[model samples]
Each structure stands twice: as structure tokens, then as C-alpha cells.
Target: MIRTEFPEALYLLILIPFFFIIHYIYIKKKKARLNNLVDKELIKTIAPEISYGKLWTKFTLLNLAYAFIVIAISNPQIGTAIEKSERNGTDLMVCLDISNSMLAEDIKPNRISRAKQSLNNLINQLNNDRIGIIIFAGSAYVQLPITNDYSAAKTFIDVIDPSMISNQGTAIGEALEIANESFGEKNKNKSKSIILISDGEDNEEEAVSIAKK
Candidate 1:
């Protein structure tokens, strides 16, 4: 259906009556002056057919026509095909640190707990990205495989604590290696990114090298 995109513009209709009233006042004052100068009966006899009511009506119609034209120029489209589209997203992995040092209260609550909270907040911002979870302490383990289920990712992140890893030490290298191997079997053509969230206290340089390759 045709609609006014600028409906607020319709308030200009109020001016039309004001303009008509001003014109009527001017015409009345002019007629009074003419009547004082000349015979009112003679003026009526000269222009008996002229009606101010008809003039006012004509002016009102002209304003209406102008308003309609202005509204049309706004380009009202009816039942327009407004296309809504979705885009395929990137493959992302969130590597979280679950080492014993993370239990230290250097950060709010602790490092590991703070990391989990940050992960939850990060997940909240994602839209269509396929994500995975890799929790590493002394060794590495894929807590959740790569999937588009954001809810599942958040669930896995929330459950991760210091107790999740049996032997607690930070092995950032092995975690990266596991992640690289896991991602290798999949389609490598897609945009793959791994976000390592940690205090960088116990990880190794091997993760950078493996990710580079």
C-alpha cells in the first residue's frame, strides 16, 4: 500500500487555513475602503457574479492539490520488494586457559573465572559465526568441537573451571597443535580464526608458529 514516508510533513496543512484567513481579511479591508469611496450598490451591480466564498474554495482546492503533489514526489512505493538477506560467517575457535595459576585472584574473582565471564560476553556479541571451544590447563582438550551452535559454545565455556583439567599446567603449544589438527581436516578455505584468551602466563610460542602455517 502507498504510504507517506514523511508523515510529519502533513502538518503543513495547518498553514493553508491561515493563508486563506489572511487573504480574506485583506479582501474585506479592500472592499470596505472601496465602499467608502464609491457606491456599494454600484460595485455590487458591476460584479454581481463574484463570490468570495467561491474564491476561498478555489484557494483551498489549490493548496490540497499542492499537498498531494508534494506527497507523490516523496515517491511512495506500494508492496515494494525489500529484500532481506543473510551472510555466511567465519569459523572461530575460543581457546581459554584453565591452569592453576588462573585461580590466583590477580584479576576480579580469579583469572579463570574472569576468562569464562569474558568468553560469555564475547559469545553474546557473535551473530552467524561458527565457533569451537578449546580448554587447556597442563595439557589440551577440545571441550566443544567447531559448530554454529552459539548456545552450546556458551554452555561449554561456562562449565570450564580449574578442576576440568586433571594435571594443571599451562601447555599452550599442545592446545594449538590439537586445534590445528582438528581444523585441518575441515574445509581450510573458510576464514578460520582462533582467539586465545589467557593471561599468557604459561603458554608457549609453538601456538603462533602452528597458526602461521
Candidate 2:
């Protein structure tokens, strides 16, 4: 895409007008000094061709050229359709806590809500990583399967709420087990990681054992 990596750099537009104002001030000061040094008639005789209107026109054109150069330095690029060869990466599964405690208003809107915001930030940083989602309370289910479809993962994450599950208790082990199962049939050699988002208030001992495996 023809995306500008440093879009904030365009704020340099603010400097353009500042430069013009300074140039105008300098020109005015110089003209005043010249007027003091000579008679009005003599000054006009010396520089009759230097019309204020023509000077302004030249300045305007120079500013335009300066703008073009700035844009060029900012690397004005034409996006080309690039057919890139596919590259494989790691499988990352995210396990989120959907328990009642997660709904506690300990953090801003709540723990669960804040966790979701953090997850959204994380997803934006990803490139080619295949990802999965699993949410569990008293039971576990495949909130999303391992896939390269990042949009689908985000959609599934957005829909996760307390009402989605019938149970209210946190079953950390169940969530881990579901995540482990989701990796079946995938390339065994690929790097795999699981990110668990929870308040760590309630967790079963089995969760540690599952994590070790």
C-alpha cells in the first residue's frame, strides 16, 4: 500500500507559513533601510523592475517548489502491487478469562474490558502469525480455531462476554487444555505460544501442570 510510515511528519505544513512570515518581515526591514539611505525617486529609478506584486509571485512559486521538495524528501512513493511469496510463522493461541471476577470494576471499565483492549493492541502488532482464541469459565470451548484469519479471531474475541457461557467460575485448566487441543494437525515444528489474559484471582493447580506440558 502507498502508506506513509511517518504521517506525523506532514505537520511540517505548519512551518511553511512561518517561513513565509519571516521572509516577509526580512524583506520589509530591508526595504525600510533602503528608503532611509536614498530618495524615493532615486530608489524607484534604481529598481523600477522590482514590483512588490512580482516579488510576491516569485515568493509564492518558491514556496510551492519548497513544498514539492519537502514531499519528495518525505519519500512520496507510488504503491506497486507486489506478489509476495508466502512465509510461514508461529502458531499463537490466546486464552482469555471469562469468569465473574473478570467483570469486577477493579480496572477502569472492568478487568475483562481492559484485557480486551490490550488484546486488540497486540493483534495490531502481528504480521504473519497464525492465531487462535479460547475462552473458559466453568467449561471450555473453542472460541476460535487456529487459522491465518486474523479478522475472524478479532470478531470472536469481540463477542466474548459473561453471558456467552452458562457457568461463572474460572476453569483455567480447561482453557489451557482446549488451547493445547487446538494445535492438533498443525505443523509440529512451528513455534507455538499461548497468552492467558486473566486477573489471577482464581486458578486451579491443574493449570500449571497443563502449562508445563
Candidate 3:
């Protein structure tokens, strides 16, 4: 669609007719003055370049140039057509337990390894959705901010281990709080969800209450 950046400049067009009127009046007064000073025939012979046709032509050209300048000042712009697509996915936060117990070999390769694999598979299935990761043991840290970059998410997930956190205990409450804070106020209107992947070893009973909040 075409638009004008300075539509107020178009108001200058109102002076176009006034330009011609003033030019016409000046020409008539010059002619009357010349007629009183000298004969019309002599005046014509003395100044052959001074013809009503030439003056009118110059006036028309000047008016056209003025109109174009005014239009140029308005700064016309054409915008590209944009196609809107609806986002049909919610914001998801995966809170993974990365305590020492996750290193236990109870689940195939290990709990932490299995959790990473599962999270990777889940990321691969996402479309138009933003996902973040919160890893916790004794404390919580944001492994990945909410984003659609599944590749970065997987990269972060692969590096998860027990040593990342200095403290050592399952603090699911802090993990949930961190996940809640990760969502931010920007996506408050969008649907949000948190998936906690743990061996149900939450030492903090406040995890459920924090989730409810």
C-alpha cells in the first residue's frame, strides 16, 4: 500500500492557483505601466521576447515544478505486502532434575542421559513454539532462555551434569520458581506450561505450592 510520510506537506498545493493569479496580475500591471510610458506597438517591437503565450507557458511549467516539489516533500512510500500467520503453540518450560541421583544407572544409560534424550526428542517435535530449560540440583539455573532455537536447546541439554551446580540436593521448588520467572511478563497472555522431568526426588515440599502460584 502507498502512504505519505508527511501528509501535511500536501497542504502547499493550495498555493498553486495563487501563484498563477499573482503572476497574471503582475503581468497586467507591467503592461499597463508600459502602455502609459510608450505605445503598445513600440513596446512589442522593443521587447519581442515578452509575449503573453511565453509568460503563460513559463507560468504553467513553474506551477507544475512547484506541485511536484510539494508532492516530493510529502515523501510517498510503498509498503511490501505481509502475510500474517497464527501461532498455535504454547510456551513450554522443561524443568529437568540434574542432581547426583540422576546419574544413577536405573534408566538405561543413566537418568540424566535419558532425560536429555527425551528432551531432545520433544524439541524435535515442536513447531512455532518457544521452549526453555531449567536445570536444578541444590539450586536452579536457566540452561536456555525461552526461544524457538531447538538446536541451541539440544546443545545445552547435552552439557547437563551434576557438577554444574556446586550444591548437592534436589531443590525442585527453586527450579519451578526459576521456570516461572523465565516465562517473563511479555508472554503472560500466551498459554504457558512447565514439564518437570525428575525421579520424584524433590526434597523441597514447596515445589508444588510454587507451581500453583
Q: Is candidate 1 or candidate 2 better by lDDT?
A: 2
Cα RMSDs, all models: 7.9, 13.1, 10.3
Tens digit per residue, CA lDDT, model 2, 9-65: 667767889988988997898789888998879978997876777887888898888
State TM-scores per candidate.
0.59, 0.57, 0.58
The whole-model C-alpha lDDT of candidate 3 against the native structure comes to 0.89
lDDT of each: 0.78, 0.82, 0.89
Model 3 lDDT tens row, 121-194:
99989989999999988888898999999899889988888889888887889999999989899856898999
- Cα lDDT tens digits for candidate 1, 1-213: 667677666677667778878888987987788889879788779978767778778887888897787676565667766788886677777777877778889888988888888878878887787788888888888999988888888888878887888897778778777776666665767777887876656447776697686
Ranking by TM-score: 1, 3, 2
Clashes in candidate 1: how many?
A: 1
Off by over 4 Å in 1: 1-81, 201-205
lDDT of 1 at 132: 87
Q: List residue ranges in candidate 2 displaced over 4 A.
A: 1-87, 201-203
lDDT of 3 at 125: 92
Candidate 3 regions exceeding 4 Å error are 1-85
Error of 1 at 81 (Å): 5.4
Q: What lDDT, from 0 to 1, does candidate 2 have?
A: 0.82
